[model samples]
Target chain A: MAAAAAERERVPFTFSAAGLDHPHIHSMVQGLLDAGAQLMHIYDENPDQANALRAKFQTGQVVQELSAILHSEVDLVATSIVPSKRGALGVQVLEHDKHFLSAKAPFTTMAQLHAAEDAVRRSGKKWAVFYSERLAVEAALLADGIVQEGLIGELFQLTGSGPHRLQAETRPAWFFDPGKNGGILCDIGSHQIEQLLHYARCKDAKVLHSKVANYAHPQYGDWQDFGDATLVTDTGVSQYFRVDWFTPEGLRVWGDGRTVLHGTNGFVELRKYTDVARSAVGDHLYVVTDEEEIYFPAKGKVGIPYFRQLIDDCVLGTETAMSQEHTFRAAALAIQAQEQAISLTKAGERR
Target chain B: MAAAAAERERVPFTFSAAGLDHPHIHSMVQGLLDAGAQLMHIYDENPDQANALRAKFQTGQVVQELSAILHSEVDLVATSIVPSKRGALGVQVLEHDKHFLSAKAPFTTMAQLHAAEDAVRRSGKKWAVFYSERLAVEAALLADGIVQEGLIGELFQLTGSGPHRLQAETRPAWFFDPGKNGGILCDIGSHQIEQLLHYARCKDAKVLHSKVANYAHPQYGDWQDFGDATLVTDTGVSQYFRVDWFTPEGLRVWGDGRTVLHGTNGFVELRKYTDVARSAVGDHLYVVTDEEEIYFPAKGKVGIPYFRQLIDDCVLGTETAMSQEHTFRAAALAIQAQEQAISLTKAGERR
Candidate 1:
């Protein structure tokens, strides 16, 4: 606990958390400030919360006003704000961070994961990142590990799919909103697709076909949580993958969560618990050969512990475990896979 | 001189220089008899030579006479007869050898070259081979020596060029006839092609493209003595080769008067000289690498060379250094390359 506090105090600068009502945002902001960051700006469209926070800050000798923090011209900034229905705090944080973090933001448009990469390159600073869970950057990292080792000789194919039932949950309406990255295939399948392309060492890939569906529990009219896709490479290798939110517990959860790699000499399978509460006890990596099978253990957390490693590498000027380019490629493939699934499904309907 | 005489006495064979009057038939007949075999029949409108030879043998002598060698009831056969023209000996010899050596032959074709192999397969019985040029075969044996030692990586590509400029000679008009294997590509290139494919592991190849020209000494009647061809494999590796009978030297040769093998890691170049009246020297094998070139010293006057080796192998149960399948593939490729060249040359004229 003391070490965590000391680390928090070392942050040196921060941003406002007034408009951020989410628990996650509150925790992140408080952690940054307590780690030696100075909160520079704060605003809340919610006047009551803003006024209450403002009064509390005035009363506390250690807490300063937002204006005073900004006038200090600190070296770094951070923020977590809850956007209204008409606004998006994520995009605002990206823009403000760009200027505050040496005139460069490491996060930008949600559609282009490489936007942050470009920002880092322009800023000329060692960088680290945090993004939506939908990105599944950790999977991409695993793919990188396989390719760099030349474990499978050469990666030749990639395919993936998603579940169809979850989109029907109407209570979380934004879950069906494509604008906010809610399509099941794009949101989840993108992670796998990106990793496949990176591992295959493919510079560019053409999508052969994709199909998406919304079946079962159709309360969410516009969302699709189930999809399948196929891709063929110029070198003649083909890949097929599927995704669905609805699966029978006994049948669906078998064989390492069904992620498999077919290689010239052998294969590898991955399994991770979908439920965070139970994942820590269940995650595994299975490496199989014609002769035998070996398993490696993995534990799950709310966020990747690996991200802290990346930050450490940046601070210490050490080599990064993965390339940012691979990350970009993975992100792009995911998006492409989703788009292809949408197009193919529409074509199938026409037929 | 003593060894030649002793070989003649032990072989129970007789040579008639008059057979050379029809060089093609003479070679075919000679090859068959040298391997200790005889044709069951002979067919000719004149039958003068056949009758004369038949009369020379006593009633109990091991000899048979028939109307046509092709239709003979004999287990094996040989022919040097030419139905149409006087100097059509090369192709006649080739045709007869091919016919008898094919699976349809009642008796296997043989020669000192295949004597040992035949003995091993036939068990103590002499197989018939009806060809001369024991020295040429010897040169082939020498070339095979380098390849077997892994001087190059697995033999991947083999090619042969020409005994060019044949048509310029005032005598031997038949030397230009395509039907008689008169051209340099067929007569000399055949040998090299066989050797190259013999070394290379390739089982089959198709001609991708070719170009041919009768640039010099058109007196041979638009006969092509210069050509180049390319072959592409199903595996995506491509080989380009050139053959020219009209090179600047009085007689220029590539490969071992017959063939050369290009390996994955290195190259082997063999050159054969069959100018019998001359010192018969110029036999060379060069193993080349990016760093240095090594030349194996020529083996001088290796006795009873290729044909003798084949005979020894047949008799002794030894594996033939060069495979028959390799020879077949090389022959097929050579034929395809020739046809492609002709087609391309014609196409070029129209353009």
Candidate 2:
């Protein structure tokens, strides 16, 4: 126990955060801490947010300016800013020769993605996205294992549906704006895009048809309640995914986050959130292969392996974690789809 | 009952079938028979198919030629032919001054839709599509009642998902051909289009974006295993829908068909075919409204009123079942989308 405590105190890499807007910063911090990262400093434009986080974590010093962390000895910056601002913050972090860990959908537009890409290329620093849908979900990890083991055969397609509850009144005002949220495809759809690239093992894909609509939320006309796109990867894997804000109150969770992967021989479905009305717990994976129709409640079976691997990559200068190109392309496809999507009103008018 | 049977034998309007290939003809026949229409004759290119139906129903006589039905004294001809041929046959039936009841996706192409429209203009015969999704699903009817009663308030969107088991072995060769099957959007997506027009109460709508992909079966190269589209009705009601042939073997029904209608006040989800893993019985309607959040099993409550209304219109020159233009436009949009949809392969390659 004394040796473990001594090792913890002798941790090599120190991490801090620049942007503290999204709630994901909590999960980001927890994952980093779990991966042996020592929090040193935290900074946000809003002092209250930084101070509250600082008090809760009871470690990181709250800094008044962003540059304080830049000048500090922090080895990495884990941040979750507004979608529109995440890219620039990432560039700043990487330019300081520090690794950058971003919340999913790090950028609202392709231009921002390109800028981040350039910064990462120039700085040779680790840049990773916390795509929680895949990275956090144990079912997804188990499913990925099954696919990698050739249990389901060659993968052909992935269909992802993220139906989220709209607690409209509780959200920040900027959440209702397309420019701020990056539309549905770039926001929630980013998770699906990353999942496709990872599970399908494809380098790039093209958006075939993409669309966004404000069905019931005409009050927030510029906001999209629903968005969908069809994509075909460079290797010929087809994908169709939808992200929507139409989850009913009966659902146990914030969303019925699910993904269905079709293979040449069989398929797997990851009920990442609530398993319908059947169970209170989530991570129910249904695997249908010729040999078996297995229902797995895969709790405790899978850990957040990405975080540990990412930490190793940041320290060792390895590409064992997710590649920067793959990350950038995934975000690029989502942002491109969001920018290219045609907007439609509930009454069938194209705006 | 005997008196009712005798009255049905002497019904004023006589109905025959021109395309007797699809299994839906049984439902069409049963619905029409229930509506006091006299079944007289049936015709198909394949005599065995026509004879099989003639023997099973033991009501309609087997006609050797299509022209016999066209030239006969039948007041209506119900048909479900190869999608590519459906429109021309409807045109032929309408030109002979007979009301036509078509299977969903009455036309495979915009040109075919236009031709049928012209024929209707010339002959003034009722042209109908059997969009059984809304017409046959009792839950949809119950939800429609709630909608018509203003329980859900101002309408905003309708999203539908129809996932059918491939049953690839039992399907005909033509079913694998895009040219014959009319692609996914024109085929299964027709039902969604019809439902959108009905629930949103919009006579016209535009297909903003449409997509189709062959994800699993590369053997059926041209066939689309999945299709989706975004649409907006003229009244500002937006729609996003998907149709896929990826229902796993675990599903009880051929499809876990469902529809959700979002309004200003609330939303209703109609589990049209089955309640999936939750329940065995179909037509499970869930309504989330201001007054109550309730689940209603409308299995026996909502009978096939469309057939009865259709019969009334056929003889009485009424438009109660569904408007001719509304039916045409729905099919037209589906066909238009099918034509306009870009194709992609399983490897994410745009073809």
Candidate 3:
């Protein structure tokens, strides 16, 4: 009883879940709950989704409206609403004196991005994003630690291949709408950009080139099935990433996402989702340095520490989870890439 | 004895080695020899190089001058001369009524490319290039067959990562001169473009964006150690490739070259040189199709039929090895990328 009281006294962190539009919300809330944060409330316009969240957590008082979550005594509000609404909701959460945790791509438009920035600056509250590809995946976390330790020397290049299956029939109408889901580069490609930024240890980078194409998905109406971008940092490190909705049905996983990091001394490759024919296992990391070649299977052992760090950041007014600037910069870069992306579908006509 | 004579009569291909500059000439010559082509003569400005070629082959006669081979009865002249001079050499060989096989980047400048094209048109002689990365690598050959068989469906994208060790101390002085070496993209990047074009079944591709950086190699005097480019084909199949001279000394091979081909029904990845930590063995191919996932270790199994095909093409006026148009297009695309490459080293100054 004394220990329980001391635990609550030592770290008083409470958060609520709102806008359960994406399945990612489950993992996001579960991470915080696992970190011992109290779930204060749950809200979604869809009663089924709200009920689902309540049943999963078996906690959180169900709320009827978004205003209720905003008005609640929660320290933070986590949301995975329609991507275009995420930035606005973040602004509202901050205006109510609560920190915000958002699913990426956090903002579908530049105006929303700016508004969120203004709200955070004016309210002095955290605005964090869940870039689960890097933060939640154990192999990525392990690679980050290895890179930080200089095991592979000065990192200079990163190449990411993010391929996701397009379960078009199961998706909501807004998922196919570019304004709501953001472009492919802004949506799935954000995960790549964020991971590259964190791994390269850069404050900012220039988007040298970007392109998007509908390819075989003209039926989806303005939906891009393929996108790629190249970016370079002031320190001269470079990144190239490609995201597409063509993951074959034979793969055991939804995608076989992979990344290769080039360093001065050696290189590292992360088979994030699956190692293809070698094994059905994901989180396979291959590290090659001057002294040795190492293979690390990062499953079950390396825990996701981002959630705990984020909770502490909210409670203690810190930036350990991720710097507010880094989060904002990643979001902005994705938006810029989307805004400036050339259309490959018009290549023949342009020529 | 009759079978041996019949085999000799069946192939009846004669070739000579000239302009022994880069060591790629060794393999270029060996592939032909393995394909039962006769090495008639060898010539180089440097007598020591000519002697080295003669010693390696233990066959070709060491000619005193280029004219000896150019004016001789040799059917084809294979050369890995200085990059800038290759086009002129090809023109001369073609004008002399002999088929010309030059090591890639084939030509350094647009003027040279134009001159070579004119020569080929006038002389009606073949001007082939040895893109050994795709031609000689067994795994690549296997993947080509797989794609040709429609196992991967309609290929739409290719990504290549080519990293090479500089070994500056051992390199000739011409290598550090951008003008002489044809820059990074026109040189090593040609291999990537060639492979991508071959895999994607693209005859021509526009260089969407390209950049080169000296990064860590300014001491080498205008030597670009890194280059990357994005290209899109007329059919909308896209390609992105990066070539660098930063292969760490730790790697067992010269570089860890990899290529990934994304198709409608599946994807194929070629670990050409080494599979990093997993194995020192090269030619590891991973195939993920709609029906099954397969792995192919192609060492000593898949024979390189390119040299034999080239010999047949020369003898019978067939385009079996690689079409004349495809060869020229790959070379032209690489030169175009090099010609338009942006310098990333000056990015900070520009900003």
Candidate 4:
């Protein structure tokens, strides 16, 4: 015990950054660095992206190649690469004897998800997903305790709405390509699916129905701006979620993401991003129970604990941060939802 | 115009109350009375119920037989009878050359709905339904104007949640009988389905999926306490609704019903019954658009106009209050959902 404590004090958990395709890599790195993890190296096809990250933290070497980070002395490698490439990259990281963490929708296709699952089994390395909507949002974290305490009783239904602004001109070419970035369900809907799995505490669920539509963005061929799906677990816990790239420019935030939990006793609603006209601050949790009706503004009060747990999970080969199975299942369900989605655009045309 | 105005002043629209199986008959009578409609007669199988209506209104003679009201000169007949009997009652009233207004879930089954439709066509008399959730609620009334003004843009999605406390002890025996009262979807779920149809501005939609569960009340045998369904209009406008009987005792109101509408430019959310933790005063409408975020507490500001319009429609042989087709379609869709519903209790058993 003394030796373990001495080692902890002697050297901190170290990780390298690879493929800064998504902006989420900044938060993922910052969260780990805040949790006392050392950032060793960074790499991106765009040198400016790697340099920008290095400048932001004033740490980590701007490496020239992906191989350099893959063969590094780091405990884990985190990436926010093009989603279709992420599955192969995760396999490569695991083969090189390091854990892998990727921005969600960890894989764009079912085949990719299958390969990643196989990689985790063969290499015995953790494959964690940065489901920041739940892990990083304070209101969601607060709701976790409320739900687990049986304050609301057994959860029976969940609904999630994620509306994101599409700054169409600013996005990369790959954003509209389904093969590169995945469809709307696989991309943004993954966050909602992950939270449902986490809060319901269930392993398996069946997708009942899913649909996608290109409501207003006809310029981007075959690019859907809206997607929704319904799923139910074996225990009859049902979930419905809608994700859209239709946030108007007049909104104050990037999105107005909300989650609602309906339980046997009462219900809980989380205004994760903003409370609209009421308040600009996020993490607004409104809970109604048998005892009381309460509103908890939990913005700064609850810190993100997932980062520290992930660091420990990487170093000790533990499953505390998130289970390997859950990471794959969430991604797999999203891919299934995307693959099976019926086109609503055709229905719209009939009108 | 002068003669019509003079005639309107001379003779107020008159109606008689027939069935008192549901308590909504009280509000139906009160609204019309307040709107200057004369309550001529009241009849129920239970004399005490008729006497209660007479005592509350200080008008409306308690008639002993249904034939007295049917043969009377009353222009319209409003009834809140047992749901399964309502369609037949409506047909009888129409055959007597009087407009019929029944409490919603106007028919218990598709066959009953078809009978009512035929009666309307044959007699050339109106068969209206009192969808009081939207007709009487002030916030819903307020939302109608806002939506018509195109402030939120073209609506693409709507979600309605209606939760009612199950005071099972106080309810009549027929309340739990699916054959007598219709299933939960055809009963309470009709309110949500009506609102969705009205807001989506579409006549027909497909029920993609539906499910019901006896979550907490198993003693009530096949009496589902929870139900939810997904539907979509031909215009690609999607809707989802969940109705339940799990409102806990601590709530200040009977239920905390809510409705949300997502449009092209923004979204609108209505806290119809109570805004928990905020105020007991209901009719809270929150509007989030491209230009502003605003909240409107519309309890006393908007009056129930459906009563007056319904009275006018009955007297003038006009379709003004609500289209006959819309009323029948709402009930038909709810019945379809109930019939096609998958039993969620079976799925719960697997867990």
Per-candidate TM equals 0.36, 0.87, 0.96, 0.97
Kindly give the stretch of ten consecutive residues in candidate 3 chain B with the minimal lDDT sum: B342-351
Chain A TM-scores, one per candidate?
0.59, 0.95, 0.95, 0.96
Stretches > 4 Å off in candidate 3: A1-11, A346-351, B1-11, B346-351
Tens-digit lDDT track for model 4 on B238-332? 88888998786667888889998888888888999899788978999988888888888899997888987887776676677789999999999
lDDT of 3 by residue, A260-314 (tens): 8888778889999899897787899998887777888998878888898887777
Worst 10 residues of 1 chain A by lDDT: A99-108
Model 4 over residues A1-351: C-alpha lDDT tens digits?
A: 344335556887789999999999999999989888889999999999999999999999999999998877798899999999999999999999898889988999888888888888899888899999999999999998999999888898898999998988889989999889999999999998998899999997888889888777777878888899989886779898999987766678888899999888988899998987788779999898987888889999988889888877766667877888888889989999999998878423423
| Best candidate according to DockQ | 4
> What local lDDT does model 2 show for residue A337?
85
Q: How much lDDT does candidate 4 score?
A: 0.87
Candidate 4 deviant stretches above 4 angstroms = A1-6, A346-351, B1-6, B346-351
Chain B vs. true chain B: TM-score for each candidate? 0.57, 0.94, 0.95, 0.96
lDDT of 1 by residue, A2-99 (tens): 44335545753334443433323444444444444555555555555555554545421223344443344343333333212212332333344322
RMSD of each: 22.5, 4.1, 2.8, 1.9
What are the DockQ scores of the candidates, in order?
A: 0.01, 0.23, 0.54, 0.61
Candidate maximizing TM-score: 4
Docking level for model 1: incorrect
Interface RMSD of each: 28.9, 4.5, 2.8, 2.0
Candidate 4: lDDT of B119? 94
**Deviation of model 1 at A258, angstroms:** 3.7
In the predicted model 4, the residue pairs found to clash are none
The worst-scoring run of ten residues by lDDT in candidate 2 chain B lies at B342-351
Residues B217-314, candidate 1: write the lDDT tens digits: 34555455555554534332234344555222222221114344544344555555522122235565555542335555455645334433444343
